[model samples]
Target: MKSKLSFLLLSLLFYHYANAQTAPGFKELLDSAMVRDADLKAQQTRNKLTVLDQHKLKDVYLPTLEVSGMASYLNATARVISPELNLQPFLNIPEGKYNNNINVSGFSGLAKADAKMLLYSGGKVRQLNKALEEKRQSENILLEKTSDEVAAVISRAYDQLALVHQSKKVLDEAKRRLDANRKTADKALGYGLITPYDHKKIELAQATLDSKMAEYEGKKELLLTQLEVLTGIDKERLRLIEPVLVPVALPAPQKTIDQRAEIRALDHGINASGFKIKAEQTWWIPKVQLMAASYYIGLYGARVKSSDNIIPPIPAIGYPGRKLDWKPTNLNIFPMLTAGVGFKWEIFDGREGKHAIETARIDRELLQNQKYDAMRKLTLNQANNQSNYNIANSQIALKKKEKEMANNALVQAEKEFRYGMSKSTQLIEAENDLEAAELDYQNAIFNQRRAAVEVMRSTQELDITKLY
Candidate 1:
């Protein structure tokens, strides 16, 4: 049964390869996929955030400038009284001259420019800068990791599409052979050389093949669709370029776990957490800043003029009102410049700062533990992938040998049947065996490639440039 199945599968595979057409290369497919994959596009965009972070880091110690202005109007009124007494009648004077009423209104405006720089922050500035740097490092590694994952997806999808296409061709060939067998059985039955039961058996087998073909055809359509979606190629235009067969080298064992982007990202996170702890501890220390500012105030409609005044004479003394001098001297605008230093201290904050420092410390420790765990798991995974790769390589050799033996058997069976020395059933069985062996050999090649892909993924080397 296994031999028969292998025969059908091998035939389709051969048909697929023999009739394969020229199509897009792996590089083109990958480039197209990079443009269409939404996840990858988002990650690529996010990768630019690191540049913004770096720019901010560069200005960590630079002063910041701000401009401000405002305008308003004001009104005021005033009243007052005075008393006087005279003993001599020769001099005339007014006692009410000392009394007066005044009213005023004006417009006012101000504009200022200020600059401030951090003089000291108890290492908080340095810690914050370091944190940003670490964050950028983490993001960079994340971008690389996303790229690797996308490459792996494309590699596997391409291989599967190729395999399915080959398999469909093999199935078509199998159907043709079954049709021929059914025709032969019909002829034998009419000549009374074979029993009706024998003819029915051939019919039954053909029916089974047709059923299997239908199932495979559906799968082939799905595979084609997947290829279309992955490569951003039109379904009608998407065709896989044949890949050249080559021996894959065994992956070198990793002596350390730092090669993976995920591990490196974790390391960056640990560094960032350490910086955060430092920043939190700084809350208890004083922060100093230097500041400079220039400002101007202007007034409108604020002029003054001299006013004439007169008063009635009193019973004992008489006097004339004199002209009073009224002048505005502050109408001229002036720019005031000032420079100073400022300091701030949190003192205490209900233990929130302490809790923050503790939280950061714990987070750093957690990342360290996570790194250790990842190293162990990744090491094991690498070993397993290597083992699978080796196993797949060996399977190809075994399948090749099997195919050779099956081919020889089929030739001998063909000759014997022609000479009336072998039964028809034996001849057909030999044919099936040869076909099965061939199929196994071809599948073994794909299996080996997939195993190598796994090894690359484990080692963080699953790049598009390494596509088979």
Candidate 2:
């Protein structure tokens, strides 16, 4: 008995696992799509770029350090220094050698280091940094807008696929009803209660339902393939579990146009342009920069040999006999320091600064116009979505009423057919009406959800996290 109980429990566990493997829910698909979709991943990468831009702006005021070094070999022709007339008479030197030149030659080395810090730039650095920061903010907002757009696509696709899935179910049930009616018609013909023509009518109806079911199956497969690609799931294994939607109260809205990410990004862009104009205006302003440098240069030059030293300098008589020593001051060292400040004023640039300032002003105006236009269009879209939502809700009510009436009519027609008071055609018509009404009701629900999504998207309130 204990073994039997264990086996039953295992069977139940396997069944549960199988059920779990059948399909994925809307939330799961959405979560997977957000991470796997290529476009969304590209947008997310911009968040890292914003961080890099922030760091760049944060370090804009910091000073920079630079170090430089150089070494070179030197050479010179022989030279002889001419003796003075008074010295020549004392030393008794020949008059021919009096104008002789002395030889001079060698290697020289130098090393230098410097640092520069901005003392003042007429607020140019500050304004440029501000512009970069605002530009980064604009990019970040644009990234968020991309995310919102992608999220809306996922929402709409999921809802449309769900609607198609529901439609397939309705068609399946209709086919089943037709098949059962065909069996009844066969029995009626066997009993000679219905003619061959009536039986053929039932067969024709079955054939029509079969065609519709085949079409719906093809459509369902196509939709499943789309979902598979979107969510990065295997096409063969991918299925979408039906979502049970509950009523959700719409969140309180801000001014839709103002809160939209597109508008906010445009505002950031305008602010950035204003800062750029200030940056350009600083072009002609007096600027101050603190500069400091330290350098060491080793000098190496020929000196008179100790033995050749005399009151009057001697000229080189033979090259092999003697030559000046060639040498360097030191191997490697830097021993010098200097400090100073600099001021610069570019008083003229052929009116370039003026042109730049004008360009910035024009860009600001263009952005202002664009923001207004975007707001107007978004406001119009918001109104339309609200209208659609209201209409969908009303249509749902109408569909529900139609379904109720069709259901009642079906019951009445079934009873009449039972007593031979109604034709099979009348009963079949009632069934088709009931099926169509249910399908329309499902469509109304789907349309209502889509409208809500649109309203949220236009208002910049569509948070994927809360979609579940």
Please list all clashing residue pairs in model 2, or write none if there are none.
78-103, 79-101, 79-102, 79-103, 80-100, 80-101, 80-102, 81-102
All candidates' TM-scores? 0.73, 0.77
**lDDT tens digits, residue span 135-203, model 2:** 888887887777777677777777676777777777888777667666766766777766787667667
Give the residue spans of candidate 2 off by over 4 A. Answer: 1-25, 76-104, 233-240, 245-254, 298-334, 408-430, 463-468
Candidate 1 residue-wise lDDT, 315-392, digit = tens: 444554443334454454567999999999888789998999999999999999999999999999888988999999
Report the C-alpha displacement of residue 399, candidate 2, in angstroms. 2.8
Q: What is the alpha-carbon RMSD of candidate 1 to the true structure? A: 10.8
Candidate 2 versus truth, CA RMSD in Å, comes to 6.3
lDDT of the candidates, in the order given: 0.74, 0.73
